[model samples]
Target: MSAATNRGGAAIGRISDLNPVEAGAVLYLRLWSDGAPGRAEMARDFAIALGADGGRSALAILDQIFGLCALHGRRPLIRHGSGCVCLGADENCFAQMIAAAAEGEHDDALMMALLIVRPDLAPALVALSEQFGLMLRRMAGRCAAPAVVH
Candidate 1:
């Protein structure tokens, strides 16, 4: 059986059913939860990898990373910013912001993560993002295990 068939086997449906946060959770559960690495770890690792490649920006790596997540059924958080903070870039840029924020303190990271999807006030952004990620992790955690290969 193919990877999807062995796992869930319904990529489109899963992608359509979730908002970005939910989709991210599922992807996290499927990929990182099994020792792939946590958000910060992945960010740092990617940073190192990108740096070694020469001339590659963190934003580019984030774009590819988020794209990979989406291809595997993850949805990207949409964002809009104020003033210069708003590069008016694509979802990948916003994702890089989140990844950057993830490198900060826990609470700060949560806030940064949320901003990817909701680019409004700063106060609520962190709390909401934290809550959303928690819920997704828990939900995805339930589905992390593979079926018995009897």
Candidate 2:
């Protein structure tokens, strides 16, 4: 099932289909896994969510989304000081991020959480991607896997 549907019922809607903040968080995490999402990407995502008339609220929401994910134990997703984050990392980094998140510095805790959860999420995301591939095949579309990640 899609991540959204896994939470409950089918996801019925558009990009706005998700809870704004939660959607932002998932997007940020996914993008971060690929590469650091720069200002342009952030601007585009926010613009789409907030509208042609966007403002600091979008920025603030993005920050909070990452922050909350960190708080909830996903900090290991970010590489320390490298500014390049990942969906996974070494055990030490994972441990530290968890500790930081537990202590309340959620914003700084995302990297570790990512590392810690990688073993679990990796398989699930992979399975989902495989399912997507099957769907694409049935539709006679090319399945472009996202860069053979990790």
Candidate 3:
């Protein structure tokens, strides 16, 4: 689902440009896990949804991940900070995420990004992402996964 679908709306391409620390954190956390084969798309969608709060920089990073995976068939590196993880997407720079860690929890990657970029948004973003992911899964008729997370 698109981020637009997750919430009611957003500012369209008005996200903040990432500072180096924020960029590094976003990329590292996203690429920190072993994502499912089709996960990057979810990562992108989730990021877009979260972008409603996080802005364009988040969208930029997630879009990059989506482009890398959806187009290049490359897995996003979700553990590159430790081993180059990109959430089943490409390894390009600039990234984003927030909210979702199995119910009432913050997704680690999203948490990391929020901490680096917008710490105030961490809590809300996680809750929204989790709720949105659950809603999307149900609407799509898939079994609910553990989280709206990567």
Candidate 4:
């Protein structure tokens, strides 16, 4: 039972048993909903994680997050002082964005999302991209640094 196929009892209830990508979707959803202080950063991290580790399963999970959110009539949120501001997007739009980006194996949805969340968070998102890219290169057994001369 691989993590991708393990969409049984636990995944329906909690994210603890999910694969890293699925679990990251859970984190993204949680932060997007909670409107917590650091939600932007956490959500961006998860978004990059999704794109960095792209696969059918990972993309499916990412799409499903937005799909379920749409089904449940949930909206992306951000905290503004004591109040909350909606990202002013429709649920279908959210689903479509995730679907499109996932298809391209990119993070456009998240990039737009973080921007909609807060303009100030752009630098952090860029940094996360570079960091995750390096991590992905290492995971693929490629050296991020220049090759050594014999």
Candidate 5:
């Protein structure tokens, strides 16, 4: 079965769908947006991994994405609470779309953009989403250190 498929041979449709990189992105975004108690620590870790400037820029892009979603009444269905780590289908979709957009898939980029913004603004959102996706990828790569056996 492909990484995108589940045990039942159906397409994975939720953030619980764990491909390591996408899982990391989903966790980061969830903590970043859901008022979780871990938010500050995760942000600090992200900053450490990407440096202050890159972290700030990446976070700004996230803010813009969320802002546009709200502005356009298409807010992503994120299911997180103060300490919950559960994943949502919408969050998975966003992570996948952002990753594809960052990979220069123009159709995915445009479709993702159109999900939250007007056509005139889709181009700009696509660029921002691409940047955000790249940052997420970098964070996942840098932070996935091998575990030490005791």
Candidate 6:
């Protein structure tokens, strides 16, 4: 995916840009929501990427994020269906918010918390999103690695 560089030359892009981590996160969410084909394989890959402890932690964080959303009566904005290859604007915004929050951007974190109508939960949400994002990055790295056969 092509990315625009910031003043510091760090690449920045929307989720539609499909950076590996964002792509993996979107794929994971899609598989999770659909409970369809490739779910098991993707889960296995995620587990392998994070190892046992990290896998468990990531699962817990994900559960908490979902639970919070449920409790707040807010559904996450996922625009694309399971079969679709295109990422929609809502999905891009959602992923971008999470990425910014994970990076400790207070305005983004506040915006997300407000979007969920849970300003009280901002810190918790930010922390969870940060951990989840890190896990996704690790998974992306593992997926990108070339296989070595002895």
Worst 10 residues of 3 by lDDT: 6-15
lDDT of 5 by residue, 57-118 (tens): 77778778767766763443444443444555555566666777768896876876675567
Best by lDDT: 5
Preferred candidate (TM-score higher): 2 or 3: 2
Name model 4 segments beyond 4 Å from true.
Answer: 1-13, 43-150
* Off by more than 4 A, model 1: 1-104, 107-120, 146-150
Provide TM-scores for the models. Answer: 0.29, 0.28, 0.26, 0.27, 0.70, 0.70
Which residue ranges in model 6 land beyond 4 Å of their true spot? 1-16, 36-42, 145-150
Which stretches of model 3 miss by more than 4 angstroms?
Answer: 1-99, 107-110, 113-116, 140-150
lDDT of 6 by residue, 1-150 (tens): 233211212224334577776676666665666654645655576578888788767767767865675576244444456567677544555465566665667587567556654668766767777777777777776778698999
Candidate 2 vs candidate 6: the lDDT winner is 6
Distance (Å) between predicted and true CA of 12, model 3?
27
How do the residues 93-114 of candidate 2 rate in per-residue lDDT, one tens digit apiece? 3333433443444545543344
lDDT of 4 by residue, 3-95 (tens): 433221121222334333333333444455555544555544544543444433333443444443344322232211212222222322333
For model 3, residues 25-126, the per-residue Cα lDDT tens digits are 343344423355324644554455444444334434444434433344322222233332222222221233322332334556464334323455545444
* TM-score of model 1 (CA atoms): 0.29
Off by over 4 Å in 5: 1-16, 36-39, 75-86, 145-150
Each prediction's whole-model lDDT (CA): 0.38, 0.38, 0.37, 0.37, 0.66, 0.62
For all predictions, the C-alpha RMSD in Å is 18.7, 17.1, 16.4, 14.7, 7.3, 8.4
| Two-way TM-score contest, 1 vs 4, winner | 1
TM-score of candidate 2 to 2 decimals: 0.28
Candidate 2 wrong stretches, greater than 4 Å: 1-25, 32-39, 52-55, 71-150
User: Comparing 2 and 4 by TM-score, which wins?
Assistant: 2
Clashes of each: 1, 14, 32, 0, 0, 0
TM-score of 6: 0.70
